[model samples]
Each structure stands twice: as C-alpha cells, then as structure tokens.
Target: DRCRVTILHFNDVYNIEERPNTEPVGGAARFATAMGKYRDQNPLVFFSGDCLNPSMMSSITKGKQMVPILNSLKVKAAVYGNHDFDFGVDELEDVTMETKFPWLMSNVIDTLTDKPLADGLEKTVITWGTKKIGLIGLVEEEWLVTLATVDKDDLKYLDYVEEGRRLAKELKEEGVDLVIALTHMRWPNDVRLAEQVEEIDLILGGHDHDYDVKKVNGKYIVKSGTEFRNFTKVEVDFIGPKYEISTMKIEVTSAYREDVEMKKIVEEFTSLMSDKTATTLGRIESELDGRFATVRTQESALGNFLTDVMVAATQADLAILNSGTLRSDSVHSAGDFTIKDLLTILPLIDPLVVLEATGTQIIQALENGVSQYPKTEGRFPQVSGIMFGFDPEGPPGSRVDPNSVKVDGEYLVPEKVYRVCTKAYIARGKDGYDVFKDCKPLTDPDEGPILSTVIQNHFTAVDIVKGLKPCRSGHHQSLIHVASVAK
Candidate 1:
C-alpha cells in the first residue's frame, strides 16, 4: 500500500493589495482563497519567510500588518529570510509570537542564547497521512553579513550543506519517512544542498522570487513565486521503499473569489491608514523600473533619478545608493504619481548624508557594489554624477574598469577627494560598503534630511513652480531642476 501528502508553499510576500494593472493581481485576499482550494487534500502549508517589512503597509506597522496575513495560512513551519530582521531581532520576535506557527533557523545560532538565532526552532516533526515528516531550516552565509540590524559577532552561521547533511541523517535515524530542508537562500545554494545531502528528500526554498522547480540527485528543490502571485503545490507518493514527487504552480488570479474572512482582516489594517497616501504629487512621462532583477544587476533610470535627487538635495558631487533601497519590485507606469506610489517604491525613512572620499575609496566601493553581480544582491550601486562599467563575468573585487570611472565629466583621479551623497545606512558601513566606514562625513546623519522628504519637497517645488501650490523658493530649486532633467 502507498501513502500520499500535499504541500502548499510560497515566499517573499510583502504587499497585501492587488497590484493595479498587473495580471494575476495577487493580493492576500485572493491568495487565501487559492490556498483554500486545497483544503480537502489536507495540505501542509510552509512559508520561506520575508513577509515582515518593506511593504507600504508593513512600513507603517513595523510589519505588524503581516501577522494576521501569515496566521491565515496556518503555516506548518517556516525559514526566516534576511528581510525578516529589517526591524531588528526584537521586533521580529514580537511579530513571530503573534503568528500561529514555528519559524526554523537550524544553521544560525545566537551565541548569547545558545540557541537558534531569533529563538527559531532547529527542527520539527509532524505526522501527515501515513508517515512522519521531519523538517529543518537552513540559510546561506552570504546574507548573514548583510543584515543591518544584527551584530555578526552575536551569532554563528553554519554551512547549509554540512547542517543539512547532519540534520537529515539525524531525522532519518529517528525513523521519519521523509526529510525536508526549508531554506531561505539562492538557487545555487539550494542545488548544492540537494546534491550534497543524500538523506534529505526535498528542498523548499526562498530569497529569489521566482516560481521554479528542479531535480538534482533525485531530490526536488521548489520555490514559489512572490507577493501572493503564485504558490507551489507539491504531491508526494510513497510506494514501498521508494517515493515519488510531483508539483504544480498555482496562480492567484482575479478568477478566484477573495476569501471574505481574510479580506476583512486585510481591510481592518488597511483602513487604519490615512487617505493622504493617495494625494497626487506629480506625473511621470516615462516608466520607472525598480524590479530587483533590473536595478540590482545594472544601472536603471529609476536609480539614476533617485541618486540624482540625493546629490542635488545634499549638494554633493556624486551619489551612490544600494539597489535594495528601491523595494516596490514593480515598474511604475508613466502617469499620475502619488504619495502612495512614492512610499511603495521607498518606504523606509533613510536619512541622507555627505561623505568625502578619495577616488580610490570610490573605486573600491564600486567594486564591492558589483561583487555580487548577477545575483541581485543589495550591495549593487545605483549612482548619479558618476559613470562606470564592469565585466559581470570578471573577478568580484577587480571587476570595475578604472578607465571607465568618471566624476563630474572628468576621469577619476585615485587620490582626488570627492563629496559623495548616500543614505546613512551605507555611510555607517552596512551592505558590504566597508570602504565607506572611515570616510569623513561632510554632513552628519542627524543633520541631514530624510530621503522621502527631500523627494517630496522636490515635487512640492515643482508644484509651486506650476502654481498648483503656495510658492516656495531658493532651497528646493536645485532638486527641482535635477528631477526635471531626469524626467
């Protein structure tokens, strides 16, 4: 006799609204309805994390808005994504407590607590159908270094392959029928785990937001799509000593009715927000590209627009911003732009600062920026008042071409000092920008203006010039000019 089980998995959801003008307009409401379609199958729900912040709603609530959304899914067990810690460990801990499931962090340990970081469970076991399923969470070392809120010294990261092998062996010895590794990492890392860990039966992964499935070494690695757009439905069948697996990608489209109960919960939080977010600020003549796949891998018009604004507002010679600062993950259409649209693109209150750095340091920073090229890492630079090119296939630290580097239309002189405008996050040396930590700050972070306000003021200035609002002068003219040119 054989047994069967079903699993529903998704990752990297940040918004709860139906993305206007986008197909499969997935929202929490519709996604909940889609999940219920598998109710009779008694499916086990699993999330690969990253639900806590970076959304317009999450920004206002410090991710509190995600609690009910996650709880609605009845997730069995989950792995933590790097963005989950954006608000710090304490906030994540508090948010997790309100949810109705366990989060796993099998490889990373909090040295202070002598336990999994964020108090996550190292492993969990559940009986489904006719067999016991054992689960463990794993992550990559790459993202651990980039977490701004966590102190690297307070935690320890274990190689996923090593941890997956050891943990799977333990689970098999304990008589579980299957061992599943829930991982929040890139595709290469997931493939590595599948190939190296013979005892693990399957890998459910996150971090990169693509719906994909691949088999390596007779094991399957699955990643559901992002933002409630799609989910992966997996089926496992056992026949004697051998088992087989199958998967389906379920799209959450308008064809499905919104789950009433979930819709109410989403509305409850949404109604708390002010209507001011809808106020029209300006019009876009061209679309702005903010998708991670685009901005993190190359220079984008949106990036240029933002960094230009930074340089103008701070009165710096050049500016560099990490691609991660743009979180909307969508292309903004050429039309009316509103406060809500602006917040969706940049939700965090990043303060601007001016740092004086030698041309050598600037080159080093650009090298570090492209170090994670083609992987969509946040360290990638989006710049203004400067231009440079790199070979994507070149060695990480040596990729940036020195001859291509320029500042204010002049080739960069290694010893020449230039004023660089950037957000305070990188100014403090986070996101692999180690060359910036020691740079002299021409303007202290505390004294600098908030990024969103500067952008809004630019719009206000434009509106003033258009005579749509009360006239304002002097301080905002430079930013308005920069923005107009970019537009």
Candidate 2:
C-alpha cells in the first residue's frame, strides 16, 4: 500500500505579519497562502515553537495576537521554546487553551504536582496513517535557569537527550512504524540527539534563527529560517516496508499571494499596530545604522544613540547595552523616526533596568562584551557617558585595554560605584555579560520605563546637538572598525 505524507515546518516566528515595510518573505498571511496550496495533501503542519512572545505586538496583546493567525493555518502541533515563557506560565497557559492544535512538551513538568503544567500540552502522539509516525516535543533544558517569567519552584525541565531518547524508544515500542521529534533547540543539540536516539526518524528544529538542514544516520533534520522567511517541506512516500523522503525549501516571497481568510486575521492585527507604528516618535539629525552587519561587529551610531537614551532616561552615570538588540536590519536615514521604526529596530519588550556596579566589575563586563570582536556576536557593547579602546586582534577575554577605560575625562576608579542602565536581557546576564547580573539592582522591573518609550522620550526631550553632548556624534574614537582594519 503506497501512501504519501507531506510534513511542513517553521519555527521562531515572532512577527504575526511581514517586516514592517519590506517583502512578502514573512507574515502569517503569506504562510497561510503557502500552506493552503498543500492543504489537499492534508499535510502535517508542525511548529518548533518560540512564537508566544517577543514581537512589539506581543507586548500589547500578551501573545493573544498569534492565535487567530495560527488557527487559520491549521498547525498540527508545536513544541515549547524559551521565549514562550516570556509572559509567564499563566499567560502561556491562556494561549495554550486558545490554540486549536496540540502544544507538545514531554520534558517540561510541574515538580510539585508531578505532571505537566498545563492540560493543553501533549506528551506523545502517534499520528495515524498508512504508516504511523510517533511525535514528541522537546525544549532545551537550560531555560530552567535563565527563563525570567516563571517561578523557580513551579516547573522543571528534564535533560533533552535523556528524556527524548526514553520517549522515542517507548513510541517505537508502541508499534509505531516511525518516530519524529519536533524540537526547539540548536542544530548541534539536534545532531547530538539524532546520534544518541537513532529510533527518531526525523527532527524538525528551531532556535538557531537560520535556515539549516542536515542528514545524520540516513535521517532528515530540518529547520526553516526564523520568522517564516522560508518553510521546509518534507515529502515522505511509503509503499509497504519501503519509504522515500525528499526535502525542499520554499520561500515566502512578495510574488506569493495571501490566503484571503488568513489575510483578514493578519490585517486585523496589523490595523491595531498601524497607528502606533505610523506616528512620528521623534527626529534624527543624521543617519543611524542598526544593520546587523554593522552593529554586531562594530561600534555603531545607532548603538550609541540607544545607550545614550538609556543613560538619559534612567539618570544613571552611564548606560551599556548589547548591539544585537537592534533588529531593524537597515539604516535609519536622518529624518523623522516613527514608533514603528523604533519597534522594528528594538523588537524586544524588555524594560530599562538600572544596576550598580563597581569599576572593576564594569571593566570585566566590557572585556567579556567584546570577546567576539571579529566575528558577529550580539554582546558587542554600545555605551554612553564613557569611552574605551580594545585590541580586537588580541585574545577574546583580554581584548579591552584597562588604561583605555574612562568616564567624564577621568580613568575609572576600581573601588568607586557607578549606576549603569541596561536592558533587562543583559542585566539578567544573557550573551556573555554575567558580571551585569551580579550587579546590585537599582531600578525595579515594574518601575522602569519600557526601553523604547525611554528612547522616544529622550529624543523628544533633548532634540538638539548641544543637549546630546557625548551621543551627538556616532563615531567612537576608542576602537577602529574591524572592517577598516581588515581592509
């Protein structure tokens, strides 16, 4: 008996629609159109997770905005992701109830009750067909330590390889002909899982934010790039004991038409954001570049502006933030800046947090921040009210020059305390800035203003070169651009 099954997958989706004003490469509406074409096959639409929060709209709707769009797509099941907990367990539970599909998570458990936290989550499943396929969902266990919103006592995540292998073997024992793992984990982790658990026939993964595919032990592993830029389709043809599988990458392009039904749902959410996004937040005197190629590897004017806003808003001695937070991916030419533009640039909804750190701790953070200078790493520090030079060609942790650190025309005193403003992401020690996490908390999360609002206020309040002293110019004299040195 020959039968065909099409497996469609995407992950790390945040924006419910397309890039603010870019191509049709993203958006739930576009994805709906892409999926509609294969609806005849009754394809299994699998999501690897991370969609519950992080986009500008999620801040407003608390992840409710994604439900209708996802419901329209008819997703079969999705795994858990770190970002899914951004809104805390209760809010995530609300979304779980609203979803039309199964939210799978086999490793996440409520320690006190000794069961899954939400009734909405699926433990394991055998999808019925000519060939039965067992499905299991897994998330990286590290979120147990770093996830911010969840109470430490509420939940626990079991090790991925240990739990996943145990579950996959059971599915095999249950007489399922094939087993698949939908995982929200880095590709390397998935590769390791494939090696350790050979029974799992395929792995659909997320979290690296890039388009990737690999074959290990004659099994297909795939991850569609983040934000729905592409979706991977796996066609499996089975005839009795024989089976053939093939994969293709499908781009959601401007050329693709939106499904009318899903388009309405997308547009409804878009309309809610249109006014906020379109309104002019402030003006810029010169072009600010927030391009990833620029900010992640160099001291960017956009980074300077953002850190300057943090300093001004928090009234801290200085502010430091990672360049990776900027997501605009394009230069903002000098002119009016809209709320939408800022949202696209600083996509995360974290609040501005102020912390107290001594000069020694700060220097350690500066060294750690620039450890990945030549390569593009997100921890590249953008600063306000200070200056420093680094030897990028030097070893990773020793790159920053101690003699180079200065504030207000004086060298930083090791014992002196200073107030520093930073994003909650970094303040919580993400991206190699652990010294920041050890610092004394100054601004409480609830009291701190939302970062974008602070930047908007800074622009509205100052509005002139004289008031914007150190931040007036974007160029940093301390360290030369790595690209320039490379040339």
| lDDT measured at residue 185 in model 2 versus the true structure, 0 to 100 | 76
Check candidate 2 and list the clashing pairs: none
lDDT of each structure? 0.83, 0.74
lDDT of 2 by residue, 293-404 (tens): 8988877788877776566545678888888888888988888987778878977777667789999999999998889877778888888778899998999888888889
Candidate 1 whole-model C-alpha lDDT, 0 to 1 = 0.83
Q: Please, what's the RMSD in Å of model 1?
A: 13.6
- The deviation in Å at residue 173 for candidate 2 is 2.0
Identify the leading candidate in terms of TM-score.
Answer: 1
lDDT minimum window of 10 residues, candidate 2: 472-481
Clashes of each: 0, 0
The TM-scores, one per candidate, come to 0.64, 0.63
